[model samples]
Each structure stands twice: as structure tokens, then as C-alpha cells.
Target: MKRIIISGCNGKMGKKISSCIRERNDCTVVAGIDKNPESFDGFPVFAAPAECPVQADVLIDFSHPSALASLLAYCVDKKLPAVIATTGLSNEQIEQIKECSKQVPLFFSFNMSLGVNLLAQLAKKAAAVLGDQFDIEIIEKHHNQKIDAPSGTALMLADAVSSVLKEEPQYVYDRHAVRKKRSKNEIGIHAVRGGTIVGEHEILFAGHDEMLTLSHTAMSKEIFATGSINAAIFLCGKSAGLYDMGDIV
Candidate 1:
């Protein structure tokens, strides 16, 4: 059986993943690390990975980006493979993950839903076929408590579209009076945060006389937990490398 260490064990997603893992016969949670250090269903909680008692086959992080450095450092020092589910990482933090990938297998992404992964692939195909002739736009919605804007999944979708178009798309989050018209080379990203929205994303392709939209909405956090667990399972015993949901799919 694969032993897993869950980071951010006290948070909603972490708790959901913890419960999900217990139902699975192939793997189980060995430990949980969170700033809260509170027990969830009797599992001991550590303030940090360094303090955790168990040696895990994989570490799944759903913590904040602010804590990423220390977590990655711990994993690197221990040579433990990890999956990073947290979003809002700066370019520097991303670079650190890439650097750490040389020492331990790392799988990271903003969204873990299988549908989102498939949407990225489909968007790439559409962008490649349509070229610059089509205008692309991404809009996302989440809960009001979410601190990040233009949700990371939106940026990921935008990046996939940009890669196929051969140009880095400039992101425009807000528009006011006197704003210039949209650029053909730009992909607009809009975000809405309100209510208890689990998650929602829509990608639009607009042409002169036609339009197409690809969308994905998350009904619950359990999907993400399940996907993260799947990623952790896939990363076990793997060599050092940077990977995402696409690699596993």
C-alpha cells in the first residue's frame, strides 16, 4: 500500500482528500501537516513536514504558496516525491519547483479535475486549427473567500491557447471607461468571485460570424481530492521530473 502525507490537512480540500483516501484499499494517509496542527478523524497533525513522524511514499500539498518554499525544501532534503495542488504561485516559486524537480518527482497544477485537463487539450487543438483568426477569452468564477483573481485554471487555459498561437497572450483582468478595444492577439480573462461557487470556467472562441465555447464547472472539492490522490499514486517510485495532469492522462 502507498503511504501518503497530506499537507494542509485542516483545510477543506485536505479534509476531503483524507476522507477519500480512507475509502481506498490501495493507499492511506500516513500523516498530515498543517499550520493548524489539529487532528482530523484521529490522524496526528504536524505543524510542518519536518515535524511529521511518518515517512511517506508521497506528499500531496494543498497549502498556500507562501509556505511552498519550506515544504519543497523539506521534500527535497528527504527526497520525497510530491504533488503541488496549491495555486497562486509566483514565477520565482514556479522556478523553485522546476529546480526541485531535478531532485524529486513533482506534479503540479492549478486545477486537478480530469475534465479541466481534457479542456486544456481541446483548447490547444482549437487554437492550433483556428490560428490567430479566432479571438479567445477565458472567464472563471469561484467562492468569495478565494484570494486569487483570474483563477489559475484560467491562466493555464490561456497559456495552452497562447502556446498554440505562437505568442504569449497578454492578460487583461479589468476594463473601465475609455479602454481601448480588444486586440486580436490578446486573450481576455475575467473572474467572478461570489456565493459558494465551487468552481466554474468557460473558454470562448469568437470569429466574424460564429462562436464556440468550452466550459467546465466543479460541483464539489472531492473531484480535486480524487485527482490529487491519483496524481500521487502515479508519481510513486518515479524519477525526478516536472509533471502535470496531462502527463498522467
Candidate 2:
């Protein structure tokens, strides 16, 4: 059976993953790392990564960006494979993940749902076929508690669409101050935060006379929990490297 350690075990996503793993027979959580050291139902919870004592086959993190340093350090020190599901990471934190991946197998993704990744792939295909005639835009909605704007998934979709376009594309986050109209080479991204939105993303391809839209909606946190678990399982026994949803699919 695969052994797992959950970081942020007390958080919403962490608890959800723990519950999901309970229904499975192939793996079990050996320990947990959270800000609060209080004992969880089935596993011992440590205040920090360095304080954790149990050995596990994989580490799954759904914690804050602030936890990346210690989390990656612990993974490197133990040569443990990790599945990181945390979003809203800065570019520097991303670089840190890349650096750490050189020493340990790391699976990192902005969004873990299979549907979202599929949407990205479809968007790429659409961009390629539509070419310069289509003007692209992305809009994402999350809970009010969410701190970041535009969302990581929105950026991921934008990247996917732009990667296949013939001409270079520029990202336009906000237009409140910019008095000019939308540019031909611009990919506009917008964010909305409101009451308890699980997650919603829409990719709009506007052309001269028609529009094409691809969208994904996350109904609950369970889908992400399931995806992360799959990633953890896939990372087991793998060589040290950076992996994402593309690698899993």
C-alpha cells in the first residue's frame, strides 16, 4: 500500500483529501503537518514539517504559498516525492519548486481537475485553428476568501491558448486605467470573487461574426482531492523531476 503524508491537514482541502483516502484500500495517511499540532482523528499532526517523525511514500501539500520553503526542504532532505496542489504561488515560489524538483519528484499544478486540464488542451487547439481572427479572453470566479486575482488556472489557460498562436500575445489584466480599446494581440483576463463560488472559468474566443466558448466549473473540492491523490500515486517510485497534469494525462 502507498503511504501518504498530508500537509495542511486541518484545512478544508486537506481534510477532504483525508476523507477521500479513507474510502480507498491502496493507500493510507501516515502523518500530517499543519499549523495546529492538535491530533487529527487517525493521524498525528505536527506543527511543522521538520517536527514530523513518520516516514511515508509520498507528501501531498494543499497548504499556503508560505509553506513552500519548509515543505520543499523537508522533501529534499528525505528524498520524498511530493504532490503540491496549492495555488496563487508567485513566480519566485514557482522557481523554488523547479529548483527543488531537481532533487525530488514533484507534481505541481495550478488546477488539478481533469476537466480543467482538458479545457486547456481544447483551448490550445481552438487557438491554433482560429488563428489571428479570434480575440481571446479568460474570466475566472472564486470564493471571496481567495486572495489572488485572475487566478492561476486563468493564467494557465491563457498560456495554453497563447502557446499555439502564430503571433505573440500580451496579457491585459485590467482596463480601468487604460483608455484605449482592446488590442488585437491582447488576451484579456478578468477575475470575480463573491459568496462561496466553488470555481468557474470561461475561455472566450471572439471573432468577427461568431464566438466560441469553452468552460469548466468545479462543483466541489472532492474532484481536486481525487486528482491530487492520483498525482501522489503516480509520483511514487518516479525519478526526480517536475511533473504536472500533462504528465499524468
Candidate 3:
């Protein structure tokens, strides 16, 4: 059985993962670290990573971006494999995570849903085949409680499409202020946040006299939790390196 430590055990995704893991027998959550440090079920919750004494096969983080530094420190110090699901991280923090991966197995992704990653892959392919003939646009929706706009998954999809393009395409987040015509070389990304819409992403490839749209809609959060758990299991016994959904999917 794989032993796991859950960072941000009290948060929404944290609690969701904890609940899902309970249904499985191959892995168990040994301990948790959370800012609230409230007792969750029978496991101990630490106010910070330094206070957690329980050792595990891997750590899964779905906490705030602010908790990244300490969590990574603990993981690197103990050479623990980690699956990071937190979003809204800055560029510097991403670099930090990559650096820590050199010492321990680390998995990070903008979105944990396998469908979303698959959508990203499809968008890249569509962009490559359509070439300069299509005008690309991305639309993503999430629950309003989410703090980030445009969603990290949106950027990941855009980046995937840009990778196959001949030139770096301009990313346009908003066009309300500028009353200019849409440029063919730019990819428009729009974010919608409201109610409890789980998550949704749609990529549009608009060409002359034709429109091609690919989308992925998340019906529930369980998909992400399950994906994270699977990633944790995959990381166990793996060598120190950076891994993403692609590694397992």
C-alpha cells in the first residue's frame, strides 16, 4: 500500500481527495498539513509542514500558492514524491517547483482532469492541422469561488496550441477597451466564473466558411481528485524528476 500525506487537508479539493481516497485500499492518507490545523477525521493536521512528523510515500498538495515554499522544502528535505494541484502560482514559484523536482519526484499540472489535458492535446493538433487558416479562441468557465481568472488550464491550452504555430501568437485576454479588429495571429482567451459550474473549457478553430469546436466539461470534482490520486500512485518508487499528467495519461 502507498502512504500519502495531504497538504491543505481542510480545503475543498483537499477534503474531496481525502474522501475519495477512503474508498480505495491501495493507498492511505497518513497525515495532513493545513493552515487551519483542525483535526480531520482521525488524521493529524499540522499548522505547517515543519510540525508534521508522519512519513509517507508521497505528498499531494491542493493548497494555496502561499503554502508552496514550506511544502516544497519539506518534500525536498525528505525526498518525498509530490503531486501539486494548486493553481494561481506565479512564474517564480513555478521555477521553484521545477528546482525542487531535481531532488524528488514532482508532478504539477494546471488542471488534474484527464479530459482537460486531452482537450489541450486536441487543441494542439487542431492548431497544427488548420495552420494559419483558422482563428483560434478559448473559453473557460469555473465556479466563482475560484480565485484565478482565465484559469491556468486556459493558458496551458493556449501554450499547447502556440507550440505548433510557426510564430508565437499573441494572447488576448480582453478586447473591450481596444476597439480594434481581431488579429489572426492572436489567440483570444475568455474566462467565465459563476455559480458552481465545476469547470468547462472550449477551443474554437474558426476558418473560412467553417467552425470547429472542441470542448471538455467537468461534471464533478471527483475526476480531479481521482486523477491526483492516480498520479500519486504513479509517482511512488519513481526517480527524482518533474512529471505531469502526460507522464501517466
Q: Each model's TM-score, in the order given?
A: 0.97, 0.98, 0.98
Q: Show where candidate 3 strays beyond 4 Å.
A: none
Q: Candidate 3: lDDT of 248?
A: 66
Cα RMSD of predicted structure 2: 0.8
Per-residue lDDT over 142-204 for candidate 2, one digit per residue giving the tens place of the 0 to 100 score:
999999888999999999998998787999998887899888998999999999999999999
CA lDDT of each prediction against the hidden true structure:
0.90, 0.94, 0.92
lDDT of 3 by residue, 1-249 (tens): 999999989998899999999999999999999989988667889999989989899999999999999999999988899999999999999999999999998999999988888888888889999959999999999998988888999999999999999989999998897699998899999999999999999999999999999999999999999999999999999999999988866
Write candidate 1's Cα lDDT for 1-249 as tens digits: 999999998898899999999899989888899999978567789998778768889999998898899899999988999999998998899999999999999999879898899999999999898857888889999999999898889999988888878777777777663279888878889999999999999999999899989999999999999999999999999999999999977
As a TM-score, model 2 comes out at 0.98
Evaluation by TM-score, superior candidate among 1 and 3? 3
Ranking of predictions according to lDDT: 2, 3, 1
